[model samples]
Target: MQKTVLNEDHRRSGARMVDFGGWEMPLHYGSQIEEHHAVRRDAGMFDVSHMCVVDITGLDSAAFLRRLIANNIDRLQVAGKALYSAMLNEAGGVIDDLIVYYLDESNYRLVINAGTAAKDLRWMAGRLADWQLAATITQRREGAGALAMIAVQGPNARQKVWQALPDCRSACESLQPFFAARCGDLFIARTGYTGEDGYEITLPAEQASELWTALADTGVQPCGLGARDTLRLEAGMNLYGQDMDENISPLDAGLAWTVDLVAPRDFVGKAALVTRPQQQQFLGLLLKDRGVLRAHQKVVTSQGAGEITSGSFSPTMQQSIALARLPLAAAIGDTVEVAIRDKLLAARVVKPCFVRKGSILV
Candidate 1:
């Protein structure tokens, strides 16, 4: 398994290590629940260096990205504006969900998921070749000038980050959400997966360890994948492999908002999405009875049978919640039954978001 630059730090901190997408990552330092609470009540940091960073640059960069992603990149007129988009296959299934940063007319940065780096690169290379576009795709995940990412998240996440890197505070303090500002060697983006107000800092690889130590010294708790999963699930964010995958359409995966079909621009899978139609409605489920929701569990609804794509006991809500793809006929206030251990448990349907910004939405 590949180890990140912070592997030794995690070991020194007594983090329980586990294999995740062929990379050895920290499951937790000692208590996953404590780490979860830390993010909600205060601040926490994650060593997300395993993720892939791809840079696209050339005279045709804008044109290339316009055809590559489902979301229209034309909206990104200002430098440092970021867009969350899905790259799809020709059949409308999601190849991967990523964030694109518009640095200039000729350069864009994409941060893709850790597991799909190779596949994403192959697809992008093939597409670029087929289009005969004059764009250069460079992987910044290894060797010289490699970048490392650290996600500091929670209500006090930004302040703690400022405490560590005081130089970045002035430049990034006023940045809006989904926007990024280049602070010297740091690319501080007001973005995170934990559904909290924070920044995902990308900097040179060798500087990651020092920053991690600095954040820790500033009372930022070190969280692991265990807390990260529950936090994102509570925030109603989709996990790539669990909630959506290569075989899953973004529309059915609760990501229709990310797809921009109203724009005049053409993307990779617009035709298929227009023709395929959305078969399922992705929504949230709150367990009304005693049972924990898990993925792949059968859902019995009045409209039709559905399934849980991702579920967990929300630490913030103190109840079992889930994100499921049910029939379009299933309304938000409807009650449904979930199959668990050969027994049916009652659950309430609600919006996909269960929590955001330390507030309960459902």
Candidate 2:
């Protein structure tokens, strides 16, 4: 199994390790619930080096991305600006959800999921060939060089991160959300998956351990994938394979806002998306009774039956919540029954986000 630069550090800190996307990653340091609460109340850091970072460079970079992804790349006019989009097949199914950073006119960076990295690269290469564009894709994982990524998140996340790298304070302190900036070799982005104020920093692998130590010295709690999952679920963020996959379209995956259908520009999935009627609607559920929600549980509604794509006990809300895709008739405020084991539990339909920046929304 592949291991990140911080694998040894995780072991030294007594983290419970698990296999995730072919990488031996930390599931939790000790208590997953405590880690989740730490991120919600204060600062927490996560080792995310398993994610793939690809650099796209060439004269036609912008043109190539415009036709490759569902979101309009033309919106990324400023340097260091980032756009969240889905790379789709011709049938409008989501291949992967990614964040593309516009570094310059001829250069852009994409962060893709670890499990889908190989397939995404292959798909991108074929698209480059089919379009006959001059753009080039370089996977950063190749060669002797290694890259380490870390996400420090929550209310105090940015403060602790700045304390660790004081020299980068000015460069990244004023960065707006969804934007990135470079301080020497360190690429700092004011972005995160936990729906909290934080930075996702990418630097040379050799420097990762030292940085992780420095951040820990600043009292930033080390979090694991388990807490990260609960945090993202509470934030209403979608997981790639669980919420949507090659068989699901962005329109039905609570990602319609990310898809640009009004623009006249044609993209890879434009034809299919325009022709296909949206069959399912993705929404959130709040269980009224006591029980843990889990994926694949049957959801019964007055309209029809649906299945939970992602579900968990929300640490911040202290309740079981989930993201479910049901028929269009399942509207907000509607009551539904979830089949948990032999019991059918009642739940209320609500908007996807349960919390944001530590505040309860629903």
Instruction: Give the number of the best model, judged by TM-score.
Output: 1
Estimate the lDDT of model 2. 0.94
Best by lDDT: 1
Q: In candidate 2, what are the lDDT values of residues 291-357, reduced to their tens digit? A: 9889999999999999999999887888999999998999999999999999999999999999999
The RMSD of every model to the true structure, in order and in angstroms, is 0.7, 0.9
Pairs that collide, model 1: none
lDDT of 1 at 300: 100
* Number of colliding residue pairs in model 1: 0
- lDDT for 240 (candidate 2): 95
Candidate no. 1 TM-score: 0.99
Minimum summed lDDT over a 10-residue window in model 2 is located at 139-148
CA lDDT of each candidate? 0.95, 0.94
* Per-candidate TM-score against the hidden true structure: 0.99, 0.99
Task: For candidate 2, report its TM-score.
Answer: 0.99
